[model samples]
Target: MARTATAAAAPRAPGFLRAALLLLLLVAACRQAAEENVVTELRCQCLETMKGIHPRYIQSVKVTSPGPHCDRTEVIATLKNGQKVCLNPESPLVKKILDKLLNNEKWN
Candidate 1:
């Protein structure tokens, strides 16, 4: 009976070791994901932006302010052709569009 008990305990030692190692790996993976989240910019939607796009080609505009995912403001425009493009916030054309959009005035 004692020998049988020892054999059962020996099998459990390897099983316990495997479970502990798996838990350790899971923890490390979680830590890596948390670190990636902390860096930000990974989730920023805009990859390329443009300037000097005429407002007449734009059907609508959406503005996103700086947040945890991005450090700079983003201006996205939906063109009349149903395509989206990122606009440069520093561009004079974009500023004028923003003014027209915010003030709800007809674009001149």
Candidate 2:
């Protein structure tokens, strides 16, 4: 009777410890995932921008207004060849194209 009681108590202690360790690991993983998601959302999409891309080469334009991630307006142009380029918002040609697109509501 004494041997069986000691064996049962020993197994119960280790089982409880294993369950606690597993719970701690799960909580840590969830915390890491949440932090990574927030970091991704905080980063800007455009890293480099071009000054003078011709309107004829552009297939479409997407203008993103400044917010939490970036402070300035972003203009992304998709070329006819399907390559995307970031356009300088302050450029004269870019401004003209933006005006045309806005007037026609052609920007995505």
Q: Which 10 successive residues of model 1 have the least lDDT summed? A: 37-46
Give Cα-based local distance difference scores for all models: 0.87, 0.86
The top-ranked prediction according to TM-score is 2
Candidate 1 pairs with clashing backbones:
none
Off by over 4 Å in 2: 1-41, 105-108
lDDT of 1 at 97: 90
Write model 1 residue lDDT over 29-76, tens digit each, in one string.
999989987664555678889984887898999888888778889998
Task: Provide the global lDDT of candidate 1 against the true structure.
Answer: 0.87
User: After aligning candidate 1 to the native by TM-score, how far in Å is the CA of 102 from where it should be?
Assistant: 0.8
